[model samples]
Target chain A: MKILFPIILYLVVSLLLLAPCALCQDEVSGCVNCHSELDDGDIEAPTELFKNDIHNQAALGCVGCHGGDPTSDDEDLAMSEATGFIGVPDPTDIPKICSKCHSDPVFMKSFDPGLAIDQYAKYMTSIHGIRNSAGDTKVAQCASCHRAHDIRKANDPKSSTYAFNLPGTCAACHANNVYMAGYDIATDQHTDYERSVHGIALLEKRDIGAPACNDCHGNHGAVPPEVGSIDKVCGLCHANNMTNFDQSTHNEYFDALEMPACETCHSNHYVDSPSTDILDGETSVCAQCHNSDESPEGLEAADGMRKSIDSLNTSLTVVKEKLDESDRKGLFVTNALFTWQEARQKEFAAKTAVHTFDLGKVTGVTAEGLELASQADVAADDLLAGYVFRRAGLAVSVFFLGLLALLLWLKARQIDARQQSL
Target chain B: MIDRRSFLDWLLGGTVFAGLAAILYPAARYLEPQEIPEAAISSLKVGTIEDFPLDSGTIFKFGRKPGLLIHDADGKFRAFHATCTHLSCVVQYRKDMGAIYCACHNGRFDINGKNISGPPPRPLEEFDVHLKGNEVYVSLRG
Candidate 1:
């Protein structure tokens, strides 16, 4: 009887504590509950699936959008009673749902009035949206990338779209062997990307210039780009290189002879490790297009760039050796070359620069190679000065001390002789 | 007659004065009165708190610097600098993506001013914000 009283008292206190929350519960249901089941075909609905979302936890509820009786417990009445009950929306209807909040200039202006309101229109024009509109249900929808619930900030590491985590998210579909096998799509893109230069740059060196999945693929309306479009996209950042490549003998030859341009030498997609070694200058990319019996122009153009790259590499080697010797001799050296220790740094810049045919930048950077050589020479001069002055000082001091010792011994002998004579 | 001790003192004093003049000449050139005004420390009224929609961001220009005022879905107000940490590019808020994105280098920042992606070296700095009556006051230091 005594224990029963305490249990009843505990229940009463708990209920009293829960009363405010229960009263406020009506303002906390999902927008889907009321708006998702209407007969309106145009209304794209996400359903009450977002009830467990963080938005709901913040007291955002169903009546906030799809007006309904929140207090009603009856399922049939809850479905029938809501004012703006829209039917279950298809993938094509996602844009309408997204645009409801996004398109309202007044609503968005409160947050970012200047925010772009054209995402829905842009998506419609995108390849992914077009394919999805045609009823390719397997295509990624808004919820696929953005997530239906648990939607956090994109900057959140836990968010699906964060750079480091995006590869894994993309792999969700791309790595699915069964899904890929149907379309003959190789599942090795994620693996291959992990090993590519961009992959190594991003994953190992944390270079942001290294392209991620979306760098090549569109963020919202992703699709496979045409082979011809790759250079134009890649050229956005590599302007100098792209310009040189277009003007190079290869591009000229291709334009005149009606052959493929730079991609002929640099294959698309599966780019291999580009080596700048003089002895190993001959590349398979050049050999494929040039060495063939039909086109001698490809062979000649490849040889010219190959020679320039070789000379640059040789100059760098000489500079590096001399710089190392200077460092060993205890001279401090500072320059762009000394700062960029990895050979790949200059090689990447030089190789791309050569393709652009910007002889000025090519010459300027290549001149830095000669300048590094001069820095080595200056370091050597300083070393010689140190050695000469230090040795001369030591020799003079030793000679003077020897002469003084001889003079002192002679005086002592003279004093002894004088004493004997007396 | 002038004593040797007095003559030595005069010599030492002359040397010291010369040394002080030499050092101060270059330092005086380097030192200049600051011309730029310090950022306002007191909170300035932005707008009514009710004007900020839930789970949205509003960009406002305070002085010469651009700032983003974000009202989270929970009705909590936050302010972040619009400048990028990497290259000082202006960042825009993508509400659907829920990130402050820099288009220059694809830099991304969370609503809480954390660097999520791209080449930014540090998180975006946040401005202090408070609500008084119906208006929102943002601190320059914040």
Candidate 2:
């Protein structure tokens, strides 16, 4: 009786240890099977679309969100409200539903510990959240951007919030005049953004590092930048340019005049690449604020900055052309090419330095660039001269060798004649 | 006074020798082992535990790049790569904010090296911090 009791106790302990392993295995939900069999498109569609959801991939069942008796095979009993089943949750309740699992550190740690938990808190401050809470059904909710049954990780290429796809996802409602008719904002943002430098880089070049719709406009707490905050928003990427702009004389004037710093010159969505041409003439960005009669000093500074950039740009172009010419001749202009690259960086620095609005600061960088360009120009010239010298030396060697060959031929003929005579 | 046969033979021998030397010299160098610098140090003794006061941060050179070693207010030693994820600009620990801050763009990273705010798309890479007695050592995390 004692031996039997010990064996029974051992078996019971072993069963307790193995129980978690059995339950931890991928669970097959009976609800999906029953829903899949249903003739109703609304019922069957979730089961089909859920196959691709991030939750489904993580082995979470339909009961994870829409709770029901996942254990039962009977259709009516399985979906009973007694088990806390809630189907087709309202838009307002979706955030709460998502945050229940997402915001739990202990629960989320098993999946992704690095994922931020404050998305719901941030969303509450957004315009969409405020409008949605006010009983407006038209505004976006958690399910609006991230589809209910087919939500994916933001990094997934197929995700609605992926860097390349995000602009288009936002444009679905934003670009439609009918949908956005109630809003006071212009609907041309998506169109303008599509043609912008950032858009071209992200969508065409597939550069994920480039800013998307969410980079400037917050992903959850999205709002338009006010007049005072425009420079701060633009400064995130162009840190040096922002630093210079902050110290510029125009900063206080722009603040007093209520002009947006970077956007005033570089336009917000449709920022085109700037050139020296923008510094002067009828199309000058400065002309919008400064006139020739009233602010002649402003015009003078702008003109000087333009000439400084042009001078350095012209020198870089000429040096680059020389390097290309030398390279084509197969003169091995590696040094000259490297010098030109350094000069190119200096030119870029000078361009960014123009935000200081000081002629001296801009010229300081440009002067260093001009020196590098001059060095490259000299190196290319040396290579060309060396090529010419090598060509002349080759001609000299060929003439003497030809003369030697002729003499050898004559001497061989003379030896043949003497042998024949002997 | 030299005959054509003898002169041609001499020239042929010199040309073949020159060609052989040119080919064999480069081949020998290619096969030979180059004296490269020693392998990168896997673990570095940053300093003694006493060198780092509570909540104080210090920067040290790790190989060619910079590394940030912080003695947090929690009394744990942690280290991270000092470069910002947004740009390649070097980052500094902002004691005031109690976070790794990049002044270049105001990018902020939490103690766990997770990017909290600003333009950083990715997190700063973290290194393993080991304490052997009073000596603190930082090493690459496996």
Candidate 3:
């Protein structure tokens, strides 16, 4: 009985040690069990918030990120330095901690084969990364946008880094007057972008293809597009307009002045659709730079281009109306209508040619349109003339037929009277 | 004997030829390169020492192309063709960056005209710089 009592005490002690290990093997570790029972808000908050986290949903436990032993139920044993328990990482060390698994291509591929592993490398090149490396803890780190405990995929609509939500997410830090006061950045970019053409397309129209904050400024390696590269950024959409601008003499002139290419005229945040008003008169973008007193020849060229475009548009309208009138009169003005359509196409070509900023090119295209419009007008006039000739010919034929009928009636009456007298 | 139709055709053709020559002659003359008397000077004097402040760069015309002259912070002068090696764009001295900067592509070059960063593939072509009694002279190197 004494030997049995000693054996029973040994068995109870061994089972107490083995019970936590058995619980750790069941997926809910000793760390979660102890933390769930804690009354501290700091300890309980992460446990509760982590329930819906992407990492938690993927079955990655707290020890995967926090770096502690999950099997031990004793607080000292689990949180000991010997077990590699690094508590909350500092702001400067956060990026490196995230990159441990993110930068590993093999690890990232296990979850998503196509996921890029260069985010850490690109983050090192960003202004935030550069400043952070220089020991500025105020700069944005991994947890700034991708919330630490509850990060979602960038494609998820609820994600702070999602395309549609990025503007508001950026504005959280950027628009805060007290937060951005130390940095010399203008906080109006978010407000300006919301009203711009790109902003309207993305926000109001819900166009997924329209660009947001990360489109012009890159995602991980976010930086202001350099003065020389502004055209290249805008050219991703306005390719043909950029091609025309790049090939013009203005490209060399602007480059000589060290000017931002596309932003100099169209602006960066508030780029509106271009119109003929940008080429001429008091409100002209050209007139803003070139006046008759300063650049007489340049002013003359701009004026000539505007006049040519206006003339071509007027001629097209007049010819189209005349062709429509002939069609309404039951005249087959198909050939005239075809010529008028060609004129309209030429007018569009002339407007695109104005980007060359060359009067000769604009006038050359406008001249072709003018010639086609005149030809169409002539065809419509001929159709109307032919209609009038046919009407006159029909009236004359009717008058001659009436005369013949009268003469025949008189002859018949004379023959009847002669028969009665006999 | 020439017929009347042939005589009229010759007259019309000659008139058209005269009209075309009248229009093309002015255009050809307009396109022709004009002689600049100032470009004849081979060793052009850019400016005096006082005109170029310490740690400053000035662009001067070397015949038709632009030439860049930099008076570095240490009071040493260097000269090179202003054109960028990548796209022939005019490069300027950025006091903030303390390097020769080509705004066209964000290309940079060291004081000695070595291509350092960005898209520039080759060094800027160096020019012979001579200082004679505070007068800076730049000329194409032989």
TM-score list, all predictions: 0.56, 0.72, 0.55
* Candidate 1 CAPRI category: incorrect
Q: Give the per-residue lDDT of model 3 (tens digit) for B46-127.
A: 9998999988899876654677999999999899988888656678887887899875446789989998876566899998
Which ten contiguous residues of candidate 3 chain A have the minimum total lDDT? Answer: A20-29
Which digits, one per residue and each the tens of the lDDT, describe model 1 over residues A26-115? Answer: 544333444466766433344444544444564555554444556666655554645554434466666667677667778767655666
- Chain B TM, per prediction: 0.68, 0.72, 0.71
TM-score of structure candidate 2: 0.72
Which tens-of-lDDT digit does each residue in A241-358 have in candidate 2? Answer: 8989999889999999999899999899888756888787445888888788888778788888999999999999988888888878866666577677667768878888889999
Candidate 1: stretches off by over 4 Å: A1-26, A29-92, A252-274, A277-282, A292-297, A321-349, A356-368, A375-422, B1-142
**What TM-scores does chain A show, candidate by candidate in order?**
0.68, 0.88, 0.70
**Candidate 3, A1-422: lDDT as tens digits:** 98899899999999998875565344344677787779998887777777767776656677766777777767887887788888887788888988998899889888777878998899999998998878888888888988887788898888888878888888888878888898999888888888887788677866555678888888889899998888888766555456778999998988898888888877787766555667776567776578778787887887888899889888888877877787788776766766776676677667767768888989999999999999999998898887787676556545545544554465556568768989
Classify candidate 3 by CAPRI docking class: incorrect
DockQ, candidate 3, comes to: 0.01
Model 1 score (lDDT)? 0.62
